[model samples]
Target: MPDAKPAPAQALSAPQKALLKLGLTRDIDLALHLPLRYEDETRLVRLSDARDGQTVQVEGTVTHQEITLRPRRQLLVTLDDGSDTCTLRFFSFYPSHQKALAVGARVRVRGEVRGGFMGRTMMHPAFHAAGGELPDALTPVYPTSAQLPQAYLRKVVASGLARADLSETIPPELLGSLQRVVHGTWTLRDALRYLHHPGPDVSLDALEDRSHPAWQRLKAEELLAQQLSQLTAKRERDALRAPVLRTAPGGLHEQLLAVLPFALTGAQRRVGEEIARDLARPVPMHRLLQGDVGSGKTVVAALAAAIAIDS
Candidate 1:
């Protein structure tokens, strides 16, 4: 049988382009847009049972909203779930915000509870309009700008994933090697899927800690790519010839060490020996010496310089 033809890429909608400020023009780009955080909407808490300082999610109707002045200009909103009433105060707000929280509109909000002048308050909560059935999975919250709505971005991402037709970017042999090393089982696509929309069965703790197998798989691939890049560059550099300097025994390096008032730490001595070895080698040295302040790196560098000069 003839192999099925590949699907053509879809152009981003005007709204989607605007929402994705990072210019995620390709399907792979959208796939790589990792969530900044996850919102678990499997269960909703009653406003009345919510405690101060706890971060919780609640569904409620906007009972009232009014612009107030005196203590300071602010927007006050009253939200009532069947269980209890809470205030949603906005010190920084605009007319559009007020319009969104019109009376009787149902919304889901997640925020840290703080005691306020108007009883229980959630000052600057992350919110979304609600009415449809609650999801049994974690909702990815992407990095967003003021102009971009979360819902709009979510829609764009969903569309991208559905139509992406993404081919495997990582070679199967390399993936297998990585899996053998880490005991991870997720594929690249699976990792992206789980990260963007984790099912209820997935451990929330692991997701938050970024220790989930899927996350680990993706992170490992990224690290492997970086390591491969470095190794390739090193190989290329090693191919080039460098001047070899064979220093005489009891050279200037030994003379400088004899005159120094302070003793060198073991670490300093080790680094000096390594640098001297590099200087003697025919290949150019590409070593990075990093140490905390007052670690005597300067002294080691000076010693290396003496070896270079004496040779």
Candidate 2:
């Protein structure tokens, strides 16, 4: 049976609906909406310690703001985090943005560092005025649309996680076997929870490298799902009857085999037999022969085609 459609979240705001462009209106959707990246907001980096090309977050007061038109039209603002000053540059900025960057206004900026005419710079960085308090754990950077409040989205997703009844996909026996092999103890829900709401102890390096145990578990689940999908498709395809194309035993089949310069390898011979069986079916034989450069796939294909001609 086809899977039941997920029920939509109750009383979604207009902006919330707009943000969910991927048709993710249900609690399950929220549960499955994995983060694109994560921000380690456990601590802020000093502007002086920030390295070029590395993504970093810094909090400081906006010390300067002015529009420059020498090379091209751009807005340049200076931020001082007490440790050092960094330039916040923008090529395309609005008057409101200029107003927001008023001198002495404290803001938090997160972006990749680059060397500019004015020393260390961050171009078009994600910035917002200083709020009440910063998060002490990993912060998720979700896929978003314009005008969507991130705080609101987080709240919605948190609610979903609280209310959604997540059905187990993997069998308990198989899960236990996999756990033994990997030495992992997380279930599907645990994996998602760890990813979505990682504690302070979770390493920033492991999360960034996608090599954490939680990430590995999720990756295994994804790979297994993909494999099962392909196998299911193959089984469905094999079930249909095909036209039998059997040739007489010692006729053209023997003639073609005799003319071949080299004898087929054991593996090739087995594959050839399998292909021969597939060709004898009433259903179309949709097969793919994949191997390295020196593998005898071409020769085996030629043999299979010769059999088709003989019939």
Candidate 3:
């Protein structure tokens, strides 16, 4: 048998692993790489009971199904999950995948419930192999895009959860200290992986019923890294940006502004004076500009350009 396994993606990292429970996260492996808020999937309700706009599990035989191509090469599949049928739209479908979705099959659909005309229960269904009744609730939905199919996205997350080589960014002693301080149990890496793919869905008690110690660690580390990066960037700017030392008596500055074709406004006059003073000082000039919706900051900038043009 050929390797049905998909190809490799970006290696999982600490920050990514922490984001698993977030609905099909914007980042795929981030939840597994960082850490997580424990997730609960035991909270599933039947499709019949799922309300409009709520995520409901449709577990039924897919009796009637149809596929049609609309204008501009679009593919649409309408499916029924017993409660009611809804259109399952797929923008890009390969020849093989379409053949697999034909009618007369048992399938599960987890999708958002929507209201339809004539008070019919409808869903934007995601097809899957039908299974037994769900015993739990609060299924974590994921983010999806056209480039990545929801099925492929689900598989990648499942793969990341299955990986045992999950690295812990939080230190042991720090973890222990966190457990003692926060009065919680699980380490950082364990929390994130277990949330999306726990061996056994267990009840936890602590912050948000979470015993994962990695939340604080992950947040603190990421924040510190960002702060340090900012600080380093500021230091680099300090070294690289040279002060204008243009502090000569205001004679040359006045002469340059005098050459402008149009007369200057009071605001422009004030700004020019400020820039001239800032340049004369030993300190570097790093000015932020504010312009109204049509304030013409460009015109103001042009006046400064005249100085260089004159020089």
Give the candidate number with the greatest TM-score: 2
Candidate 3 segments whose C-alpha is farther than 4 A from its true place: 1-55, 61-107, 111-124, 132-147, 157-227, 241-244, 256-274, 281-284, 293-311
User: Considering summed lDDT, which 10 consecutive residues are worst modelled in model 1?
Assistant: 12-21
In order, the Cα lDDT scores of the candidates are 0.83, 0.82, 0.55
Instruction: Please give the clash total of every predicted structure, in order.
Output: 0, 6, 26
Per-residue lDDT of model 2, residues 269-288, tens digit only:
99899998988878889988
What C-alpha lDDT, on a 0 to 100 scale, does residue 214 get in candidate 2? 78
TM-score for each of the candidates: 0.72, 0.74, 0.47
Better of 2 and 3 by TM-score: 2
Tens-place lDDT per residue, model 1, 154-271, is: 8778778767765666787776877766566777777788788998677778887888888888888788779999999999999989888665679988889989999998999888
TM-score of 2: 0.74
So what's the TM-score on candidate 1?
0.72
The lDDT, on a scale of 0 to 1, for candidate 1 is 0.83
Give residue 10's error in model 2 in angstroms. 16
lDDT of 2: 0.82
